[model samples]
Structure formats: C-alpha cells, structure tokens
Target chain A: MVKNKIKTVACLLLTLFFLGGCKKTFNQPQSNPEAVFNELWGFMDKHYPMFAIKEIDWDKTYAQYKNRVKPGMVDAELFSLLNQLLFTLKDGHVTLMSATDTATYLGFYKNYPLNFNLANIKNNYLFNDFKKAGPVMYKIVSNVAYIYYASFAQNISDAELDIFFNDIKATKGLIIDVRNNTGGNPANAEKFFSRLINQKTLVKYEVIKNGPGRNDFFEPKPFYISPNGQTYAKPIILLTNRLCFSTCNDFALYISLLPNAQIMGNPTGGGAGLPYNYILANGWKLQYSATYTLSPKMRNIENGIQPNRTINFEPQDENNGKDIILETAFNTLSLE
Target chain B: MIKYYSNKTVFLKIGLSLVCWLAVVNNACAQTLNPDLYKWTFTLGLGLNSNSVIDKNFSQLPYSGNGLGLSGSITYQGRLIQQQLNLTYGMATLQNKYYNSLYATYFTANYSPLFCLNNASNSAFKILAGPQIAMQYARRNYSGFVNNNSSFEFSTSLATSIEISYSIIPIGLVLKNKIAVPVFSYMQQPAFGFATFFANSGSQNSVKNSSDFLVPNKFYRIINNFTIDKQLAPRHKILLSYNLDFYKINTIREVKSIHNNLIVAYSYLL
Candidate 1:
C-alpha cells in the first residue's frame, strides 16, 4: 500500500510538470496613408512574380511612388497611387479590391483590337440558339460544336462536361472560343483542357516566391494536366483575344499544345501570375501575384502567349454584321 | 538539442523539490497524510468570446472579433500534499469583420500542476507551470472574384501560472483568479500564400526548420482568468468565469491574437 501511494505521488508530480495550453481579432486597424502605401509597395517588392521577368527596377519604382505618397492623402488618392503601381506591372491578375472600387490593369487590350464582340456573336452565330451550362455557352454550326467558355473561374461539373460533350459528340469538329475570358480558377483551366487530351500532359511549370528578396524563388516545379475523365479526337479550334488572361492565358496555351488544336486571334493578356490579397494597416486591401506561372516551353506567360495564327476580325466585317472569328474557325475546321 | 537539455534540467529540479516536500510531510509526526483521500472535480463551461487578430498578413492591426467556445477540465486535488493536477481542453471560432468572409478557429489542450500554498480545501494561492501544444486553422472564404484562402499552424509553448482562490462557505461564494504566461515557443507557419494553394491537384512544398525556435525572441502568450462559484449543495455548483488571452509571434511575419471570454458552467465534485 505504501509503495503504491509513493508511485501515485511521483506520477502525479511528474504529470504536473509535463502538463500544458488563432483568432479573430475583430478590432479595426488604425488607418494611415503612408503606412498603407509602404505595406503595398513592400509586398510587391518582395513577392510579386514579375519584377525580374518584366525588367522592372522596383526600388526605382518605389522611389518614384513614395515621392507621390503623402501622409495626409485620402483613401481615394492612396488607392489611386497604389493602383498605379500595379498598373506599372501591367498584369491583369494584379488587382485592388476595395469597398469603393476594384482596380485592374487593362493595358493588354488598351492598345489591341477587342477581337471579340458579344453582340456580334449573338446576332450572327449564336442567334438565340446557344445553350448555357455553368460558364460555357454552346451552339452547333455547320457540323461543328462551337463552345464559348466565358471565364476559366467558372467550374464545369463532371456531369455538365459529360452531358455537353455527349450532346455534341456527333459533330465533325469543335471550336472552343475563350475571347474576352479575362480569368478565374487555374484549376478550371487544367480541368477544361484535360477533357481534350486522352493522356496526362505537362501544361505549365510553376515557380513560387519563398523569401522577400526579389530573386528568391524555388526551382520551377512542373504542373501536369491529368486526363479530365473525357476524351475527344476531333480537331479543336481554340479562339483567343488580348483580354484573355491568367487562367485564360493558361487555358489557351494548354490547348495550343494539343496535336489537333489550333490557336487563332490576338495574343492573350498575360496574367499567368497567381495573385493573392492582403489588407493594409488602414483596412484597405491590395492584390498582387506571388506565384510565377510559365508555359510548357518554360517561357514566362506574363507577356502573353502568342497564337499559332494571329487573325484580326476586320471592323468592316463586323459592320456588315458578321462574326469573323467564328466564320474563320468554321471555315478552318470545315476544311479539316 | 538545447531545448531537450534545458527542459530535462527543469524536470530534474522540479522533481527534486517534490521529493523534498514529500520527505517533510512524511516526517511530520503530528499530521498523517493519505493519498487515497484525494478528490476529483470536473467542470464543463460554454463561453462567449471576443478576440482580435494581429497578423501582419491580414492588416497592420488585425480587427477584433467575437466567437462562441466551449471548455472543460478535470482536476485532481490532493488533500495531504496540498496540490492539484488539471487537464484542460478548449476550442473557439472567430470571424474577422473588417476582412469579411474570413474565419479563424483555435484548439488547445493543456496539462498543468498547481502547488498550493495552503491545504487543498482551503487554499487561496497556488503556483503552476507546464507545457502546451496548440493548433490554429483560419480561412478567408470567397470574396469578390477570389475564393477559398486558408492557413494552418502548429506550436508548442512553456507556460507558468499564478492562481488565487477565496471562499466564504457561509455565503456560498467562491472566487478564483489565475494568470498564465508562455515564456517561449517553437512554431511552424506555412511559407506560401493561401491563394497560391490551387484548388485542383494543387501541389505544395513543405519544409521543416527550427527557424522560429532558433530566433528565440519572437513568440509569447499571456492568459488571465477569473472564476466565481456559487454552491447550492455539497456536490453541485454554478460557475461563471472570465478569461483574457493574448498572444503574439513574429516568425515569417508579425501575428498577434487576443481573446476575452465570459463562461458559464456546471461543476461536479467527487
């Protein structure tokens, strides 16, 4: 009995010596202009994926912007200055989402032809005949399935992909139009392209920023596109425009790699960079890419991916009420 | 290796102190001590908690938020040794209002030994020290065009606590105060941003380093708690408590969180 009691005492003492112990801090941060600007600028300097690739001198960019940032600047002026900094990166994925406004870089299409018009397509091609599933719109034209995917972010359910493809399986070929599809989920890009390839294909390589230093990046890791559970052998004509970016850019590049695929129209707005957002000390939010994405050829897609056959739909063709991109895709696939 | 050696030294020193105390109690002829006379008490509590996140990843000063949480503990009180052993578990979920659509949840399990200054049934002062392991998971859900951003972290802390209790049996009122501080911790935080974690077949590189622990100057947690018990019978009581917890770390970036809680509980002593 005494031995048992001593053992119990020792065990209790030992247990006592070994024993132990994230959060919503809902309080608003003190808002300040200069501090917020520094947070935004510092984040990009350290993590933005395109500094070296774009030949941007960030320190010099900081010197120029910091001169414009005043401590007493209001929310609008601060937001304008910060948005201007992202605009300098010329990446569409670089966005500032705030209560009053959302900012994005549209320089990709500012100097280029739109290369796509919804009104023109609906009047000439779709003609109230297009079927909608998720972010995909489809219509049959001259024995071809013309499917328009408006955004890469829009998810296509397995059932939707199955039904949509099954409905159009008898067509002679496919025209996948992604013009004006700015971007969305990159996973969707891989998934949508996976439906075209029967085997696993390496679509893109990714390099992640590890440290705050401009050049600190892990070695490129290959991102693969696994077969998306469906197979099609018909030639696919993937259309593009300058506004197509990020995941959109990725999707166009992946399709362009397929043996039976052809890419036509303007080069995409390069947004292959993956953007993440952070709130400033003043609760203003800033968005910028931290992950650098590259094409299968190891070319940085931030400068946009060039199409195999760059075709501009002439304004005269649109004035005559014609969908020139669609007409070109139909004519090209009709020949195949 | 340094942590292993220093913690071992701490165990040895405390073990020696306990053995000496046992020796003194055993030699006291006027008092007889029995280990079988120890009593166990269990309490279950639900709390309304308010908190703030100070992660540099979020904002300069993370906004304050509120949450509901549950806590329960099993305590063994030694009448002869004038000591107690407590094992506790607690969890809470909080939302960041300023950064709308973001949620953070925390889970912690703690074991601590209390050395009473007086007899267990009549003690007013106690000292406590122990180790705690904790984990946190946070999510910033879909906002505008971006969706499903999340993060997870794990850490271990060495905590020391001081507790005081006052009881007036005739008035059926009992009050207790405890303050605990974690002097050091080793923590692991994800290197890449949550948005970079792709939703489909997303790949991540996980690297383990003692960098947070090696820095030595980065992390801390302080907890203050107050409890009041109103007894209706010898075996049953109503308990109310307020807990204030504050934590800060600067591993990859500066992150801080604070929680204030008001708890109501039912107590059972056996």
Candidate 2:
C-alpha cells in the first residue's frame, strides 16, 4: 500500500510540470497608435530592400514621421503618415494595405510622359483581327513579324513560341512589343529570353534579406537563362515605355543584352526589387521590397533602366496613323 | 550557444494545477483492485489552452489570453504486455487568435507491464512507456504578408505515462489520474517559408525541401489528463476528464502550441 501511495505522488509531481511553463504571447497586436507606428517603422527598418541604393536616411525619416503620429487617430490618418514614410523609400513596389484600402507609389510612371497607345496599334496596326496565338497578340507589319506580349502574367509555352516564331520565321525580322507590361513572374521572362540566346547568359543577380538587421543580406547570386535549342536568329527589337515595371523592366534589360536584340523607346519604370508582405495588428498587410536585383553590369536599376535609343512620337506622326517608336523599330528590324 | 526561456505564465498555471491535484489525491484513501479486466474508452474534450511562441525567433512578450482547444481520443486496454497493454488513437487542435492553428492526429501504443501489484483491473499503480507517432499540420495565414505559410509535420516520440487508479465501491466508481509526457521527440519540419506538399520537378519553381521525414531532436510534447468514471450499468459508464496537451517544434523558428480541455463522455465497457 505504501509503494502504491508513492506511485500516486509521482504522477501528481509530473502533472505539476505543465503549470510551470506559461509565457506571454501575441497573435494579433493591440490597437494602440504607438504600437502600430512602431510596427511599421520596425518592419521597414528590417525588410526594405533598396536602402543602400536609394540613399535615404531611414533613421532621420523615422524621427520625422514618429512626431506626426498621434493617439485616437483613424487608420486612414495613420496610413497617410505611413504612405509618406514609404514614399521616402522611392520604391515603386513598397505598398500599404489597410482594412478598406491600399496605397503604393506609382511614381516611376506617374507624372512621366505616356508611351505606347494600344488603341492606335489595335485600330491602325494589328487591325483588331490580329491572330490570337495562345496568349500573345501578333500580326505581320511591313514584312516584320510584330508580336506584342502585353504582360508576363500571360504564360508563354514553347509550342506557342514555336508556332509564333515559325509563322514569322520567313519574315525580315521580329518586333517584340512589351510596352505597358507592369510585370509578373520572372520565370516568364526567362522562358522568353531562353529562345533568343544560343548560349547561357547571366542577365541579373539577386540578394534577399537574411536577417532583421537593415544591412543583412545573402551574398548576391547569379540568375541565368539557358539557350533553347531552336533559336530566333533574326534581328529582335524590344519596345518599352515608362509604364514598364517589374518583370517588364527585367525583360527590357535582358533582351537588349542579346547581340541581335535592341531596346527602343523611353526609360523603363524600374521595380527591379522583389516585394514581400507583412501583417499588421489591425489585420492590415503592408508590402515592401525584400530582394534586390541588379543588371548584368551590376547596375542598380531600382529607379529606372535606360534604353539603348530614346525616341518619342510626334502629334503629326500619330495623326497620320504612324507611331514614331513602332515605325522606328519597324524600320530598324526591316533594315537589319 | 542559443539561450532558451520557457513561458513564465505557463509554469504558474501548470504548477497550480499540480498543487490542486496533489491536494485531492492526499485526501483520498486506497481502495480495492480487480485482477481481470478488458475495456475500451472513448473520450471527447473541449477546453482553452494559452499558447505562447517557442524560442527566440518570436518576441518574448506576454500573451493576451487563452485560445480554444479541442480533442477526441479512443483507448483499448487488453492483456498484451507485462500486465496490460493500452493502445490509443487521438486527434487534437491548438489554435491561436492570429489565424494560426495546429492539428495533430496520433496513434500511441503503450504497455504497462510493471504495476505495484499486477496488470489486473484492481491495480493501485502503473508505469507505461512506448512510442507515440503523430502527423502534425500547422498553418499561419495573414493574407497581406509575403512570408505567411503553412506546413505538415511528421514526428515520433518516446512517451511515458504514470497512471494511478482507485475503486471506492464494489464496481460502481473509479477515479484515474494519468500524467503523460514525451521526454524527447524528433520531427520533420518543412523548410522555412517553403511549401512541399505537392512539390515536384516540372516546369520550374520546384525545390524539394521535404526530403527528410525524420530529423533528430527537433520536437517535444506533453499531455496530462485526469479522469473520473462512474458506472451506470453493467457495460456503461459516465466519464468526466480534464486534460492539458502542449507541443513545440524548432527549426528556423519555434512552433509552440497548447491545448486544455474539460471532457464529459459516455463510455461502454466490453
């Protein structure tokens, strides 16, 4: 009986282990004005990708914005303050999403001269009945295969590439128009780049944030594309505009690197950095760049990547059903 | 070397429950035991578990309150090992307010071969040790965040259970207290911020991080349930139980979870 009693005591002692380990936890942050501001500040200090190149003083920015925050203010009021802080990053990808709304910087394209009037091309060039080959919209223009790839969001299959290029294989050259593409998956850009290069090419490099420290980074890694056995040897002209962001910017930089390809039009609206999301206490999600990408020459293209030739259309030229940029690419492609 | 700190509040609550249990057992006297027994128990419980994040990856701050936890278990006792063998199948959930939750479905086989007396129905004390294997699925999703992700975990643990049971009447009432803890466990954690549920080599974007289903010394778990069963008929009984279950996993970050439940169930003894 005594031995049995000893066993009972042991079980109770073991049960005590559970009550001894509790600690404080937080799944959601409280709605404190100060806490929300601090979270935003901390998140940016740790996650923003382009601080090194943008040359903004984050500490000074924090001190300036911290003074504007106040208690009993609505989310919208606080969001305005955060928007101002984010705008200081000069990043086109940094964005704040609240319960009811979203705010981001379109500064790259906004207030800049517009390019690529699609309606003019549809009515005057492709004539509204351009063959819809898979996800690409294309037509033959003046003996050149004019293929307009609108967005990388649209998947491009190798079979579709074969069909499209095969149709234009007999033409003088190829005009690949990706004008207003705000970007999507970079893999699509790789797939499209693969068809142009006969050998592997290192187009860009990337470095993602590794730690909470503002300076933390993984050593930059090379991003490359391999040659597709079947290649397009004809002269390739890539069209661009200020509205080209993200993958569009990446694509323009890459396609222009090809020996046979040339980039024409205005500078690209650069968002070469990759964006990631974080959840706020109020269930709002704020997005900021977490990865930094570089051009082949190790140039920071966060603000904008320049084209080989900068050209603009005139009013008289457009009134005559001629886009000066497209005509230039057409003339260049036909001559080459 | 990494520094580790367990939650302070958790120690207080578990410590208090331990004191309360000690108080109750001390007041009760020993009773008779049955030498022959064969039975099956099915239990369902609902309770709240205050869970805090594990390790230094998360902020070490006080949590607001407890989250709702639920569990269901089935056990069978038969003459298999030394005196008795018990096999249990259980499923448990530990959820927090941040839209993060953990679910574990498990199978445990334990043999209580050594008793203060025998493996009979009327044994005063029993010590059981065996393996508890479980598949754990965890999810954390806050839509706007870029790194919000989910994972599926597989683990094996060596479980120890100390059980004390007493019968006050001929065969009418029985109170049982069991404290079970997995001394150490190894779990398979998915790669940080990567999903491998359907990972395969194809068009691209396939990095196989779910390579190992067994990793060493990556997990720990604990559960203690105290139950009182009162016989209603020859083969029927009413059971009331209170249980606490906790789980932790550490790789890049810690996945700490807790479950507590007060269970009332109808048990049929065969």
Candidate 3:
C-alpha cells in the first residue's frame, strides 16, 4: 500500500510539472519605430536588385531619416520614398505624371495639326526616313512624293529638309508620313510645318516658368513659315496612327493649321508633358510634370489630335496591294 | 485429523502454482507488446504577447496589449510515418495612451511523419517532418477625440517544421528538440516570409540579423528547452518545462537585448 501511494504521488508531481511548464504570461504591446526602420533597411540591403547602382548606405540612411519622421508620417512619407527610388533609373521614358496633367498636354495638339498617310515599303512604314533608299521609298508615277517619318529623331538637316520640300512642291500632292512617330521636340515639328504654310502665325503660346524664378515668361511662338520662299499652295496630307504621340501630334496639329493641309489616318497617342526632376531624402530621384502647354486659340489638346479625314488602314488593303488612304488623298488633290 | 491436514496442504500448493503460472504469462504478454508501435500524445502551450511592423504601419501603434496565447496538439506514431494535428488560439490588446487597443488570433493544422532510429526499447528517439496550414484573424478598436474605428483582417499561410524527440518510460520523461521553417507565396513580401521562417526555424544565430519586417521586436529569441512529463494516473500526466530564448533587440526602444531572449511556459495533459 505504501509503494502504491508513492507511485501516485510521483505521477501527481509529474502532471503538476507539465501543467506548470505550459503556463504563459502575456507582455504589454508597444510600437518600436527603430526596430521597424531596421527591419525595412535590412530587407532592402539583401533583396534589392539595383542596390549597387543605388549607392545608398542603408543603415546610415535609416538612422538619419528615422528621427525626422514624426507620428502621422504615413502616405506622404511613402510617396517620398517611392519618388526617391524611381529617380535612380534616370530614363526619360520612365516618369510620374498625374492623369490631369497628361490630359491637359494632349488637349494642346487637337485643333492645330493635320494628319496624313505615308507609303509602306518592304513592310516598313516610312514617315521619318523618306530619304532612305529601299523598297520602302517609291516615287509614284504622278510625280507625287510619299514620305514616312517613323520617328522625329531622324536628323534631317534644316537645309536638306528645305530642298526636299522644294522638290515636292510641284507634285500633284504631298504625303507626309507620321504613322509611327511617337514624338521628340515640338521645334522639329514646327520646322516641318513652316515648309507647308505661307502665313507667319502664332501656332501656340507657352509660359516658360511661373513665379519669380529665372526665365519666366509668357510668349506666343510662330509655329509655321514657308521655307522654300513659297508655300506648297497644293494639297499637303499628314498621316498618323495610334503610335503617333507627343511632338509628333504637335506636328500634325501645326500642319493642319495650313489652308492647303489635310489630316488623314488614325488618332495620335495622347501624351504631353514637360518633366522636372526632384530628389528625395534617401537620394532617390523622380520626375513629374512641371508645366502645361496650349494652342494659340487657347484650346485644350489632352485627348489627342484627331484626323480631319478619318481613314482606317484595313488588313485587306495590305493583302490586296492597295494604298487606299494615299490614293484617296491623291484623288482629292487631283480634283482640286 | 491427520488426513484432513494433508488435504489442506495439497490444496494450498495447487493454488500457489496456479498464481505463479498466471504471473509468468502476464510478464510474457507485456514483453511481446510494442510500445513504439502506437503512441498518442496531446500538448497544450501558451505564448507571450508580441507586436509587428504590419501592425504598426497599417494599423494603429501599440497594436496589442498584454495578452494570452493557447495551443493544443495531438500526434500518432507509426513505423515510418507519424501524423500530427495542432490547433492554437491567441488574443492580445493594443495598449497605448493615445490609440485604442487591438486583438489578434491565429489557427493552424499540421501533418508530420516520424522517422525512428532504433527499435530496441519501448522508449525511442524519432524525427518529425511535415507541413502546416494556418489562418489568422485580427481586430482593432479606437476611442477618444480621433473618432472610434474598428477593423479586421484575415490571412492564410503554409509552414513546415522538423523536430527530434525522445520518450523514456523508466524515468517517466519525454524530451523534444524541434525546428520549424516556412515558405511563402510570391504575392506576400519577402520580409514577411523571412519572419515566418525565423519564427519556426528555432535557430538563434541563424536569424539574428534577419530582416523580417513583419516580426515584432520582442520575438528575436532562440528557444532551447528541457521538459519533464510524469504520468500521474492511467490517463493523466503532469509536465514541467523551462525554456531559454535568445533575443537581440534595439535597446533604445526598450531596455532589452535585441537577441537571445527567453520565455517559459507550463501545461497539463488530459
């Protein structure tokens, strides 16, 4: 009986021990901001792909900025960090612009420029490189010149551009191809427009700067002039597509202002903005819109520069070997 | 009188022989039965309170106040595979003067396979491996001039763990060494993944400098434990355990080491 009693006591002790071991006490909860910062910093140190180019001392950066962050530093601080990080890419194509700003920029191109069609050669559209020798460039039997400007970047010198315009002035009609031009500088488009119009008129007004900063001024700029010492006087057609954007749309708009110019093809890509850069506390950089532009008549152009004569480039046209839009332009010019 | 006495002695001897035979048979039967062939153990544990960055950044600060944690588990043993199921529930309050308190809870299910190293004793050493699925729920409450607000969040996760354990019946004690590791889907951030991994890995030095943004500052501890369980009755058991967890944490925020922290818990099995 005594032995049995001892066994019972031993079992009781063991059960008590197990129950005690599992008992837990809760601790008070609180926010540790320094810990939070360190955690984030450590993750970026190990996982960020562009850590080398970013050239940031994560520890020091966090330590320095953590103190400055007071309570209620939520979305504003997050946006600042994102801006800093994206600026390191340094690509013009990469940027942040509000939807409203983008809309405003597109609206400036709608009323002024004309659009037209350019001939396709060897499956390549030639609007920006009409001078390049290939099956892409073919002079028609009517002595009409058809040019495709793929991009505004094709550096056609001012003198060479004038000579090309002079050569095409007497043709039955001119087809300025901008089907795929995304855009570059508005000045380039203005120069091309000058060759088609005789009137020296202000096509757009720009405010270079606001406030008491340097180079702040509001001025009207002459958009087009006859460079051959005479206007084309004949019908000039501008071609565009959805890929036509930025200064390319500006070109279409400016050219459309001429009495003899007509816009053909699809709508332009609506993106217009003058970008400015800002640096964040973390040494990251970001670019955003700083200004807006408008046509001379104060019309908004954010939606896109619409074509005067809407023509669809059908898939069947390619299979049938017919330049439907260009032929329509020619027939219209011939009637005139 | 002589005849009667002789008959009584024979009867006594016969009874003695029968009793001895029964004892031998019982001993043999006990020896033949394998203890390792089948085992069922139930465990209950409680964890101390903690806070995380997700709680701090998205939710209000002091996301959890002093709170209690509860967990229970059942395991089955086979020659090569051991199956286990676990359930856990925890609640904490967010204690702050300015912000209102918050509550959080989690539930998990796990399946593990056991690998035995020896077949010699009823008490043997085994390794366990398996995956676990978990669901978490959280709630927040606010008061004062800023206006009262309450919100709840739900999430699901998967985890894996490896554990080594020894059961010895002579001393009526069982010792366990366990490690847990977790892998997360890409939709979740890597910081959270690292935290989950470290929380289960049971590695003190491995995750000392780990940048798991989601883990609370107080959780950076490596837990090493020694446990003693004694069977009180046929179905009742008592357990006594002590654990030392290493924590190394920012001292400026709280007067504590950021690593090598320690916590102790005790439980009874029914």
For candidate 2, the TM-score of chain A alone relative to the native chain A: 0.92
Native-to-model Cα distance after best TM-score fit, residue B225 in candidate 1, in Å: 2.4
What lDDT score is found at residue A18 in candidate 1? 26
* lDDT at A27, model 3: 36
Ranking by DockQ: 1, 2, 3
Winning model by DockQ = 1
* The candidate that achieves the highest lDDT relative to the unseen native structure: 1
Candidate 2 lDDT by residue in tens digits, B1-270 = 986657887798799986775444322211212233634655454444444432212222212234454455556553332233333344444333444333444343433332232333334444333334333443433222333223444555556555556554565666666655665555565443233331111234432243233233455666656667788876677887765556666554455654444556666655
lDDT, candidates in the order shown: 0.68, 0.63, 0.45
Model 2, range A1-336, lDDT digits (tens) per residue? 765774565555445534533323434446577787887787677667677788888999989989888998887888888888889887788888776888898888887766678888998877897987777889987789898888887888878887887788788888888888888767777787887888878887776655567777666656777887578888888888888898888888888688887888889898887665556655556777767778778888777778789988777777777788998888887776
Better of 2 and 3 by lDDT: 2
> CA lDDT of B66 in candidate 1?
65
Q: What DockQ do the predictions score, one after another? A: 0.23, 0.14, 0.01
TM-score of each: 0.83, 0.71, 0.35
Real contacts recovered, all predictions: 0.42, 0.18, 0.00
Q: Candidate 1, residues A1-336: lDDT per residue as tens digits?
A: 645643554454334322311233445554678777777887677668678898988888898988898878878888899898878887776788678898888787899998788888887778877888777889887889999888876777778888788888888899998998988877677667777898888888878766667777777778777776658879998889998887888888888789998888889888777767676666556777767778788988887888888888788987887777778889988887
Point out where model 1 deviates above 4 Å. Answer: A1-30, B1-38, B79-101, B117-145, B169-172, B183-186, B195-197, B200-216
lDDT of 2 at B133: 39
What TM-score does prediction 3 earn?
0.35
Which 10-residue window of candidate 3 chain A scores lowest in summed lDDT?
A98-107
